[model samples]
Target: MKSVMIKNKYWDIAADIYYPPGFSEDKKYAAIISAHPIGSCKEQTSGEVYGAALAEAGFVVIAFDASYQGASGGEPRYIEDPTQRVEDFRVVTDYLMTLPYVDENRIGVLGICGGGGYAINASMTERRIKAVGTITGANYGRLMREGFSGFDPISAMEAMAAQRTAEVRGEQLRVDDLLPSSPEEARSLGLVETDLMGATEYYRSDRGRKPNGVNRSMFSHQAAAVGWDAFHLAEVLLTQPLLVVVGDKVGAFGAYRDGCEIIGRAASKNKKLVELQGWSHYDLYDKPEPVGMALEKLIPFYKENL
Candidate 1:
């Protein structure tokens, strides 16, 4: 894997490129843009895990950090705007197309967790992306309304309104932890769900922890999610081949339901949904068994489609 930077508007997106075994400069190869989840970075699950795995499977892959977070440049860090999130995929695709060894027509995308929803949403309008896949797909917009545990809708709205206003007045910006500092604290807070528990463990501990994966975000920016929907218009515009891989575990995050909704709505005639029974949402993040199970299907899906 080699680290590189891709231009996005006025800033740069930090990313790592993983070349397939015996890669060649003279040969054009299928490429994939692997996006990490919200509050995660390229070096963790996306770059080192799935990105490396997919590259070894013969596809050149690039794993990148989202803008406004994780080594990427943007003002007022930790903004999770849904619109811009989808656009980030386009920036990555443009950079991928520039490489002489990357086949422009055979590019694909795979996103994990929240990145999954963004991937599907981006693929809807990004015709250059020939195929799409999601593992434990999460719709951040749906999550804010239906699954978010941090704040009730009414309070979240009021808080965001207040914070955004306060920031404009030169008050200190408000940033909050995306999860408890540890699993023990999570359990004490009654966050007993598997996804929540695993999130605290994974993000806060060495299990999946990294410095750039700070697991926090600006408090006011979350308001963008309340009114957004990742699957918006997918039924009409999502024509690329689609694949959704998710665990059977149902939890607060709603990845399973989001996966089902996208599969039912996507216009892709060649789509498929594979369930890894008994694996929870976080299991697909870095766990070998489930990741292996997911890649088994993903490797072939991209291979055949791209």
Candidate 2:
């Protein structure tokens, strides 16, 4: 395995390349680019685990910090603009194509959690992405537009409009704290016990916690409510093969179903949806038992499609 710096005009994305043992530069190999979820870094979750695994599986896998988060370059810390995040995928793909050992034609992508939406959005514009796979995915646009659906619509719209106004005025808008600051706050935020149980685990537990990250921020420029839709171009994404993987848990499963229903409605052919039984959202993020299950479906999908 080796590390390389991939730079572009807008940002410099740091990537860790895992080459199969005894890899040769003379022979081109298929490549896989893995993207981390929102508010998370490459090394903090399942993104790193599967990146190393897939690299050992013979594909040249690269895991990168998205443009603004982790070790990558971006400003206005913790801001989550949907458009910029999707572009980060393109930048990663652009960098990968320049490698001599990578078969640009066979390149594929795997996005975890919110990254899945970006991956799908990227595929809409990037034909170079031959295949795509997502784990415990979420559709940021739908989540923002609908606010967990059946929950509240008026509040969601007001919050979005407010954030948009703030962004336009260059005012720092509070999107969300990375996590609840205290036990009382956690309960107040409703993150402690809800349908998103896995979220509490990921943000609060050592399984995927980080010291540098904060639960809330003044301006998450990419607030689902304020920023551009991650799936705006999804209607035209059928040209590339897609694999959508989800856990059995309600929160994650519901999002997966929504994504599939939207893309499947748009795609012409070559799409798959797999639900991992007995697994919750956080399980697929890092737990070996459940992640292994998700990967089983993913490996075959790419092998056949890519």
Candidate 3:
């Protein structure tokens, strides 16, 4: 793996590029861009799990930290802007197109969780993406509007507006944690929802924790997410080949339903949906069995399509 930076607007996006064994600039290869989940960085499942596996399977892979988050550059960090997140895919695709060893026309994408949602929305117009695969994908806009699990968007928006007003009035920026302090706390609170339970174990613990993945939310900038939708116009514009994978566990985050929605909504005639029974939304993040099962479908899909 080689760490590199790609310029996006005025900031630099921190990314890790993985090359297949015996890679050579003289030969062109299919490439896949891997996008991490919301509040998560490239170092988690995106780069460390799926990215590595895809690279080993003979395609070049690049996993990047979205701008304004992780190791990427941006101001008022952790904003979770849906538009900016979708744009990140295009910026990374631009970088991929410049590499002599990468066949731009054969480029594909793999998005996990919130990243999946962005990938779908991005592919609608970024025709450079020939294929799309999402694992436990959630539409961040939907997630926010529903208050990350039906917690009341109206009340949440009211608080967000208040925070923005306070900041404009010379108050300090307020950052909020995305997860509970620990997995134990989540369990004790009866966060039995697969998304919350597994997220706490993965992002908040050594299983996938990293210094750049503090999982914080920018209070003042959150409302930008409410008005966005990952599947917006997908039924008409999502023409690229699509593949979606999800675990059977239906958490409050509703990744399972979102996965089904994309499959139904996308215009791709070659689309496919795979369900891993007995697994939960977060299980697809780092669990060996589900991950392997997912790649079993993904490796062939990219190879055949790209």
**How would you encode candidate 3's per-residue C-alpha lDDT over 1-306 as one tens digit per residue?**
999999999999999998898899999999999999988999889999999999999999999998899999999888888888989999999999999999989999999999999999999999999999999999988888885625687777888899999999999999989899899999898875667878899888888889887889898788888878899999899998899999987887888899999999998999999999999988899889999999999999999999
- What TM-score would candidate 3 get against the native? 0.97
Q: By summed lDDT, which 10 consecutive residues of candidate 3 come out lowest?
A: 147-156
Candidate 1 overall Cα lDDT vs. reference? 0.90
lDDT of 1 at 59: 93
Per-model TM-score, in order, reads 0.97, 0.85, 0.97
The model with the greater lDDT, 2 or 3, is: 3
Q: Model 1, residue 199: displacement in angstroms?
A: 0.7
User: What's the TM for model 1?
Assistant: 0.97
lDDT of 2: 0.71
Clashes per candidate, residues 3 or more apart or on different chains: 0, 11, 0
Q: What ordering of candidates by TM-score runs from best to worst?
A: 3, 1, 2
Sum up the clashes in candidate 1.
Answer: 0
> How much lDDT does each candidate structure score?
0.90, 0.71, 0.91
Tens-digit lDDT track of model 2 for 184-264: 556677765443556666767666677633444434343453445655646665568878888766663255566566456
